[model samples]
Target: MQSQNELRNLLQRIDHKSYPAYKDTRGSYDFGNYVLSIDHVQGDPFAAPSKVSVHVRGGAAKFPADLYRMKCRRLAVCDYLLRQFGQELERVSFKAKGSGKSGLLAVSRPGQEVLERTACQMDEAKGDLVLRFEVGFPANGRTVNARELEKIFFTFLPECVSHSLFYKALDEKAVYRAADLAEDQQYIRDHLKEQGLVAFVADASILPRESGVSGRPMKDAVKFTAPESMKVSFALPHAGKIQGMGIKKGITLIVGGGYHGKSTLLKALELGVYNHIAGDGREYVITDDTAMKIRAEDGRSIKKVDISMFINDLPNGKDTSAFRTEDASGSTSQAANVVEAMEAGAETFLIDEDTSATNFMIRDELMQRVVNREDEPITPFIDRIRELYEQYGISTILVAGSSGSYFHVADCIVQMNRYKPQEITAFAKEEADRFPLPEVKPPKQAAPTFERAVRPDRAFKEDARMKLKTMGRDGISINRDTIDVRYVEQLADTEQLAALAYFLKYAEIHVFNGKRTLRESVSLLMQYVEEHGLAAVTESSYVPCGLAMPRAQEIFACINRYRRISL
Candidate 1:
């Protein structure tokens, strides 16, 4: 139960050999006596918060684990001082404090904006916590005032709380105490208790500017490795914020109700894609090996497109007189855009399918082709995107409505239900078995009694037929005492039928077929009769009062069953 103040005092009491002071052009201190030195605490003599440097007594001596412990202890002291006294520590510096270790831990206050940047490291051996600060230096060897250094360090050191310094210092030692903010494991368990999810705060560190650059130019590979996995919520706002789903590759879907910030999140990702170089303001730790941007061809001005002629008709009208057509129309341009992005060496593709032309993407004929594998257009394009990620190496992030055929093909589903102070939850079917929601059980049958019942002839047939006709006209169709038509109409195609079936089974809706349920099945059948020019079938089958025999017979069966069940 040692307080941070006690911890700092204990850490500073560790052994240190003293040395002598050497006066310079400006005022100087006896830093040579100490293993660490406080150098230039602040830019100006009047600035608050001190900037300190740890100068190894002989530049050749090493401190290895002791240096690590010292760094952690110092961080804890700074955090404790800032929190307790409202004074900030501007920066800390250390280099090769250990005999053979290679690295420096330089902590500074760059700005509040630095907190938003995600820090990742590739080599733990070379990893160090870097802090960038804006400071002024003397033109020559002019001395910086001690008061100013102290003021600057005290003023800004509080910002380091985001680094979780106090607990990390305790982590340096093997001590299990009541932590104000629990370790990642405890934090995860707490979140699981509250929201049925366990999110870990992987590794949070500071990014080094020099480490990622190759020579003077930025390297093509934007590599980042985190020491641990970060736990993120599933219901947070996705706009311009990085909500880590912890997914590495393959198709990831960002789904949610409209106006939930899916598009905004995609835009943020787009910005990252274009500005992925190290030290860039919008750089992100893209550990996925490679990434690329994908967008529909809505307003694009294509100069030329190379496409095969066999799969489609050539434009024959005046529009073609001005430009060459790829598939008889400009509607299929979105597919062409994806193809081009792939050809351009995109390892990851981002697609928003709403902008894709209906004729090319979702037409019944085209859908059938995609479903049957007859002529894979969009399906082949999607399949190739996956194949490239798996075989040739490519990944895709596709954004579309929650209700679409894409769900069938998506490897991961990230639904952004509502915007708030929460994080988005991403579900991977392969990693978890939340797929195909459990089926709804039938209504519990009433315990049987020892009574025999009989029904009258033609009981309630006319009333049932009239009810079925009325429901059918209003777009409700019922079959087998279950709702079918309304849900079926909501479906885009048969592929999404499984989801609807899940709804029927679990949602307690009626099921007519093995699992198919329609609210107004008979009515839908009647409407189908009318649409298909089968009015004569209805007229010829009606015995009286404009009632068709087949329709009447179906109604009689349903009504009789209802009566028998009621009895």
Candidate 2:
């Protein structure tokens, strides 16, 4: 490694040279406290910024062992550190002056949810904590402004590393608090199965957001309070005794009038699969980690899936057991989504009627009479929800504003009136008893073996590589094929979508074999992730900082949505 002073001398020599002179700086420099590695240099100042990383020795960083002792706590600490470093970068960004994005600095910005990201990583056993980010190399109209870049490297970056990476320089109480909160969150998850709960929403949690456009908590909004009958208490290590509503593992229905917060509550449950940062509101709201938000995705392609449990007997006589379609109806797509969720090992389903197919969700008495059972092909979710829970142990939390057909099958019902939830299971059951539910057919099949093979579509099999990129959080572009995930409601970030693309790239090259099932292939890939890290998916020598780890559910969702995957 070159000494910092030697780097300064090189920058002085390269001053006023062509922009390509910056490439000479792409290597490791030994600063006093940390090692700076410039992994990739950008040729143009306006292009994507140069990739860089800082490695701080454990002896100098001085973080506690317990902070990274467990995988969960390590993720929490890493997230917190990334936020801190992001703030520091913003503080010093563009301090040095030049043209065309010169002297700009940035790291991956996080949102309300706390997800594992490659922006920050700590390996105590390896004796280093690394943080990766991007920086705009200083340039003045296609000429190198090496002195300005030198100031950023020797001055601004040192301050960021000192304040953000070193635990001693940070607020000790806040750091420990973040780590402890992770433990408490993990405690809730560890006990949920034993307590027969699929989700928990802490009392006084602010469930409403500031607006449809913002994820921040609403100011002066009504704080959520659970009905006394449904309130459950837990003794957390840090927060002590806390009371909340425990949603048991079974079929649950959320019913209410329009604009009465039914969808709001379900929306909270939808994102509860992730741990949130402090002051984000709904921090205590935790759902089954494997919970998936199911919605109707019309026109999406479905490659070989067994959706017969909810959909069968198509008029076209297309086999429902191994269903395939390039353009699926809403009902067919919804059924395929549920089946795909099951194949991904989702333990719970979170559905909102607004995004679901009407015919797939319920079939009313009048509709059943008008459309005879023989003519109808779809079984509807209302008839088979009970079996989903009782036979398969899959829990469903559904939001419905216009229908009461779900009341008969629901083990618990919660009414959201004016932004407040009240237990109404008994009352709803009484109403349903007065008008008995009509008989419906049982599930046509048992639990699936979940063996779906993935082969490239015939048109693309001959191509050597795919041009894959994430289209924000809504879709991924693989070659010319588009995998729309706009209705996969649980996807929270574009970073996660990017990671999914990388995972698919990695799988296409290594994991997928002729015999391995989709489930088996994902399991093997997950093992690699557990052993290595998300950056490993890039298959690069340098660690990338842009990717945020996605749950296996989203990975399955990615493959399921890709149009180029053949049966």
lDDT of 1 at 242: 32
Candidate 1 residue-wise lDDT, 5-24, digit = tens: 33233323421211011111
lDDT (10s digit) by residue, model 2, range 1-567: 989888999899999999998999989999988999999999998888899999999888888888887777787888889999999999999998898889899999998988888888888474368899999999999999998998899889999989899988898888877778888888898889998999999999999999997889999989999989889989998899989999999999999999989999999999999888788778899899999999998899998898888877788888888888999989999999998999899999999989999999988888889989878888888887888888878999999888888888888999999899999999999998988878876646756558887664444345536677888878988777778988878888888988898788888777776578899888998999988878888887787778998999999998888876654
lDDT winner: 2
| Per-prediction backbone clash count | 59, 0
* Local distance difference test values of all predictions, in order: 0.31, 0.87
Superposed Cα RMSD, model 2: 1.6
TM-score of each: 0.30, 0.97
- Which window of 10 residues has the lowest lDDT sum in candidate 2? 455-464
Off by over 4 Å in 2: 124-127, 456-466
